[model samples]
Target chain A: MASTEQEVLEGLAEIVNEETGIDTAEVELDKSFTDDLDIDSLSMMTIVVNAEERFGVRIPDDEVKNLKTVRDAVTFIQSAQS
Target chain B: MTSSSDTRIVVTGLGATTPIGGTVPETWEALLAGRSGARTLEFDWVAEYSLPVHFAAQIATPPEQVLAKVETRRLDPSSQYALVAAREAWADAGSPDIAPERIAVVVGSGIGGVHTLLNQWDTLREKGPRRVYPLAVPMLMPNGPAAAISLELSARAGAHTPVSACASGAEAMGYAVQLIRSGRADIVVAGGTEAAMHPMPIAGFAAMQALSTRNDDPAAASRPYDTDRDGFVLGEGAAIIVLESEAHAQARGARIYAELAGVGMSADAHHITAPEPEGSGAARAMLEAIETAGAALSDIAHINAHATSTPVGDVAEANAVRRAFGELAGSIPVSATKSMTGHLLGAAGSLEAIFTILSLHHRVAPATINVDNLDPEVGLDVVRGEHRALPEGPIVALNNSFGFGGHNVALAFRSV
Candidate 1:
């Protein structure tokens, strides 16, 4: 459903913010989910599940591990779409 | 608090979130007032499941309303109950300044996170895998309550959860006593919790014919030792007590409740659901507690019975007491606490242990709520109507907890 990588990242920021109480406005491509954002692993599962639903992507457990940063998730979603 | 002997273990603190009240003081007050906490169910699933038993003794103050919104969201109800009671016990013990590596946690539950598991499964079935919460596995695990408390208190020495059906909570306290005696830890936050007021458990229990169908008069339903007593009133809550060596408590000057003198355990090895009719296992558990405490039958001034109000269980337990205490059983005041608090399942043992400890402190025994016509078959002297003052001088009390799968545990507490 996201038409661009920027759109994918923006959509994910909202989901992450809702799940982990992190502010979506501060979310960026350079920020890591665990280190920079301080999001826990349980919240990461929610982020991955939501992304799969919102972007119509199949982010399996193995693929979820590689999605370390906001940019990684955005790129993964965009590439999978293309 | 100074220990003069090697096996001297003392209870430094106590806490509970029970059917009667939220905190220890409130629960004790209500217990003395002879109040019943059972009520009709507010959930729609009670009717949906067509459960024969439509009422339960739900906690007076639910942990959700007390905990933060995010906390309630992340932790299952069972874990929430554990956190609430554990924090209270820790604070009650003056928040001991023990090393993190020297402290431990042991909280048990009969059926853990049943509500969360059933709810998540329903979500996955109806809305797909994406709708399933990521923390579902941890939230639904049987040991989640103990794990949550361990993390909350940073108990690195060891975090243990002992599951033994309804005997789980009592077993945790028994384990804590061993941990201190074995030099594993100085202080252990231990107890039992149960949050299984959901439809699946209710239906399952109903199918097994374990619940009373006293839909009309819920308060008088848990009539233990009464001629017409049917079965137990399903209940939910948690109770925790802090255990420490007498030397450790004396070192910190922590106010002591009572000596968690000894725990006696046994297995019927006969029946899984039904207790051994002769009460052999139950009696052995009582005898073991007395022997372990180095106390004679005459030393036990009172008993907090595991009388679940089941027609068979009450008599079996009575027979067990008779066997263990001999002629002394008829003289010992037996308080069937479940008559008022209903049955807390896993939480019953620790809560009753708290009650036993409190009974020793208050110098009074709380009465059983509804025993309109005491069964003639029941041989023990049932505490009824009003709470009675216990005799002066040092006294000992026993709290009996027998669970399904033939598990029997008896904890003996002595006046400080």
Candidate 2:
């Protein structure tokens, strides 16, 4: 599992790139998952579930709402893992 | 777009990704060569699930062969097949110079994305609901194929999908003819596709005794109008045609294959799965199509019958032909296409439609293979053993398709 926020963001970018057709380089920390990445709510859920599996963490549905950006998802994954 | 009656609509292009071959020319050649597309499926789930009637006619060329990896990953197999055939038809039409606003798409399917729906459900159960693919709904949608083609060409007129069991493809063509006849679109990409080679559908159809259980010799399973015929063999593929108004085709110097003169549609309103035993509704559909085309019964030279190889269905369709055209129907050589291509379900009609158009264009009728003994109940002429050439003159052909819900469609085509 990725320990640091940078490492978590990198992993998230890769997963997002695979799940969605977005370019890996474009999945920056500040990029909004919906607006910037253009991922719908279902795909956003997919990204969260895939991230949880990748990081070995549990992302509850309620917390999923706060994961609006790449940074938010990365931070949440880091916190959940710790 | 006002009504387009009194004007002619012609089929300028044909495309198909079927069990026999991937393209129209290849499929026609295979059909004429008396080839059978059926073979035992190699999926692991077959043995694991113990699916009855293990054979099927899978597509000869998969969509992954033509489309990009990412493209295949995003779309369901049904849409993938549609896109492959639609692209071929579009290109074959010389990429007709028409406004996007004046274009349309209508692709039908008996069942859509069954594989995706089932696989996603499996994932949901095993890996939890969150593990399922996000685009499952769109991918599983029956209209996905038509929508994908509509988007590919930016067809602004409309994107329609008619889900009428096996008759869906013919119904889609019927709807396309109406769209053009109604002046809603100058050009319409129309056809049908199916990719439900999954274990569930096979098991279900087997449970209903709708599929042949001749696992020993798969090729001879679909012996439509033949005495040895047991039942239909499941097949999957897509077929599309580029239909344009005669005025539009002539204006662009498009090579017209046949005139889509008319379409007749009706329903048995009887059974849910089994066809109307008498085929009275099917007969009406054929008669109405000929009447709608304003062509005399004597004018029909060829017929692509919906002989799905089922024992009951074959006799009913034969009776329908006789009832529809009287004694003249006996002389009309009928091409029982399912004998080779198997039963394409939703895609059967368009594939047969393409075959009919090519038959009229080439003035040759492809033989139905594996008919060692013709059933006496089938009164119509079932072309077998060898391909036969047609008379040298303007010719008209009819294609019949009947579905589970007793839905029936008859389309009339004439050579240019």
Candidate 3:
């Protein structure tokens, strides 16, 4: 089942929260993982892997660099799903 | 180079998460009570793999109970145990007012992060390479414990890991004394941590016949110096001590446990796994420790022996002690605490060092339990049946720790 954009954002936020201990409310779409959320590369990988399992979407390594912010990740997931 | 005696060093604080106890105080109390920490293995893999040995001296309190979830997830169990012990020791030292550059961390391990390495290997083989954790290398490195503690305390002086198998902890402590005496660091968090209680190590040890096979009676299995002793009971945990220069400690009015007067280390070129039967190398380390401490034979009152309870190793260490002190070795009250705590591998030295220091501080030596019938060949005065009270006044205690690869370390602690 393809997840809606709102559903993707919520799901991604939960993954980020679990991996980084950042508050769910703080994982806004505009927040940059490195600057705003303070998530390092290793933690980002963990979150990405977890998100892939949770949403049933494959986030390729090449595309990981393109995920600059929460909005970017949600947009990428939505496009991949469609 | 300045002599070790010129710059006095003392143990300001101690910590441990061992089979007998989660903290130093608890372990000390259990040691005094003559309690056995070994028990039957509870993991299903023991049965699945049909491991000959079914028990080990597992950690009394799991790290997850003491550490936060995020910390536990990122660090390996070896580092987790080191962090737990280091934190306790630091807090016990009243969180010394030393600069980051003036403090260092040296935690050694006989087998570091074996659980992580093996588990990751299994994951890689079963789930494919992509599924392996990114932090696997850092988590599995032998220096992970020292690095973890250095990171935790922001220690900038130096982080060192001396891997000498079982003697690693004591050697690390010996190195800590060098660090302070040589004017490199004012305070050093030195000790050892090991968490190799996985099925693989158990099977490996069993293959070598290094472990006791008394699956039915685990506690009595590690009977050091006992005529019926078979082999050592595998164990795991970490023990840490806050070592600081006397000048720095006195300046800050920090309480001192015991003065770590000197450390001696030697190597037996005889064999890789087996100790030199005559114990010449071990005796040299013991004699060097006493000489370095500037202690006369009469001043040495107690010994925390490295009696792992293995049939050959026990006798070898007994011969080593007799060779070192000659006639006086028979009179010194010796305690093989491993009979209760089992062999903690790398952490054995530091844990036993803490026991030796506590023996001096409390003026009571903990008893060596399970020696129902002491081996007549072991001529040393093994303290058994009940704890022995030390004579009042100045005295020194020796903590001996030997390891595979022919490593031998002896440390002397003088009561303040």
Candidate 4:
């Protein structure tokens, strides 16, 4: 089943919040995980792995590099789940 | 190069999260009160694995109660304990005004992150390689505690981890003394931390008959110097101390606990696990510590013995003391604190060092509990029943720690 974009964004935000302790409200789609969320590479990897499990999608190693922004991750998870 | 001995090193602060207590004061109080920290394993895995030894001197307080959620999640238990102890020690030192580059951190561990390593391995086996945590490597490394503390303090002089089994903590402190005296750093946060409470280590020690199987009476399991003692009771915790050059400590007006007068280390090269029967190496280390401090054997007032309660180990340490001090060994009060603290392994030396410093500062030596019947082979004047008061005036105390693979360290601390 394909989830809507808003649902994917909220779910990814929750994952980011858990991993980086960033407030979920601030995990806007436009924000970069590294710059805006202040997530380091290790935390970013953790968030990615958790997002894959949550969204029921396989976020390949190559795809991790392209996920620079919250929107990028949400979009990728949405498409991969579909 | 300036000779290291020319610059004296002093202990500015002490911290510990041990089985007996969560902080230095609490631990010291418990030590003086003769409280035992050993208890049966409460984890469900104890039954799940049926480990032969079912008790340990677990930490008095859990790290989660002290550290932030994110911090606990990121750091392994070993690192968590180290951070907790280091924070307290740093605060106790009044947060020295030294530059970042002028301070260092050295923490040792007998086994580094066994909990993390085994948990990650289980994760890998169950959840696949991709599921392994990204921070697993850093969390499981032996240097993790030192690195974490260095990062916390922004200490840049150096972050070193000396792995010497049980002597790791003492070795780290000894290294810190050298670092400060050699002008590498003026202040160093040094100690040891261990969190190998999992069933694997328990079972391994059980297989070797290295752990006390007194599951029914955990409190009396660690009976150092007693004739009935079978082996040591495994323990997990961290003890840290902030060491600064005397000049720097005086300049900052830090409360000096005691001076780290001298450190002696030697290797047996005789056996893998069993100590040299005659304790030649151990005696040499003890004598060297006194000589390095430029003090006579009679100057030694108290000894925090490395008596882990193991039958052979206790006797060996007793022999070492007699060999080192000769006639004077019987006069000096010996306190086998492990009888209460349950053998902290890597952290044992530093925790006992802290106990020794507190003893010197308070002018009393804590009693060695659980010695109902002292071994006939052990001839030292082991303090038991009640804590003993020290005579007034300048005095020196020794904290001895020996590790498997024949590592021996004797640290001498003098009353300030």
lDDT of each: 0.90, 0.89, 0.92, 0.91
Error of 4 at B399 (Å): 0.6
Q: Give the alpha carbon lDDT tens digit for every residue of B1-416 in model 4.
A: 23266688899988899998999989888888889999988999899988888889999999989998788888999999999999999999999877899999999999998898999999999999989999999999999999999999999999999999999999998999889888899999999999989899889988989999998999999999999998999988999999998888888789999999989999999999999999999999998888888889999999999999888999999999999988888889999999888888888888889999999999998889889998889999999998899888999999999999999999999999
Off by over 4 Å in 4: A4-6, B1-4
Regions of model 2 farther than 4 Å from truth? A1-10, A23-37, A60-72, B1-3
Better model by lDDT, 1 or 3? Answer: 3
CAPRI band of model 3? Answer: medium
The candidates score, on chain A by TM-score, as follows: 0.92, 0.92, 0.95, 0.94
Higher-TM-score candidate among 1 and 3? Answer: 3
* Model 2 residue B374 distance off true place after TM-score fit, in angstroms: 1.0
* Candidate 4 residue-wise lDDT, A49-78, digit = tens: 898788788988888889999888888888
DockQ of all predictions against the true structure, Cα-based: 0.45, 0.50, 0.62, 0.74
Name the top lDDT candidate.
3
Fnat per model, in the order given? Answer: 0.50, 0.56, 0.38, 0.62
**Pairs clashing in candidate 1?**
none
Candidate scoring better on DockQ of 3 and 4:
4
At residue B149, candidate 4 shows an lDDT of 97
- The deviation in Å at residue B19 for candidate 4 is 0.8
For candidate 2, what is the TM-score?
A: 0.94
Worst 10 residues of 3 chain B by lDDT: B1-10
* DockQ, candidate no. 2: 0.50
Q: For every candidate structure, what is the RMSD over all alpha carbons to the true structure, in angstroms? A: 2.8, 2.2, 1.5, 1.4
lDDT per residue as tens, model 1, A1-82: 4468778878988888767767788799999888999888878888888888888888888888888888988899888877
TM-score of each: 0.92, 0.94, 0.98, 0.98
lDDT tens readout by residue for model 3, A1-82:
7889889999998888776677899999999999999999998998888888888889999999999999999998888887
Q: Give the Cα RMSD of candidate 1.
A: 2.8
- In model 1, how well does chain A match by TM-score? 0.92
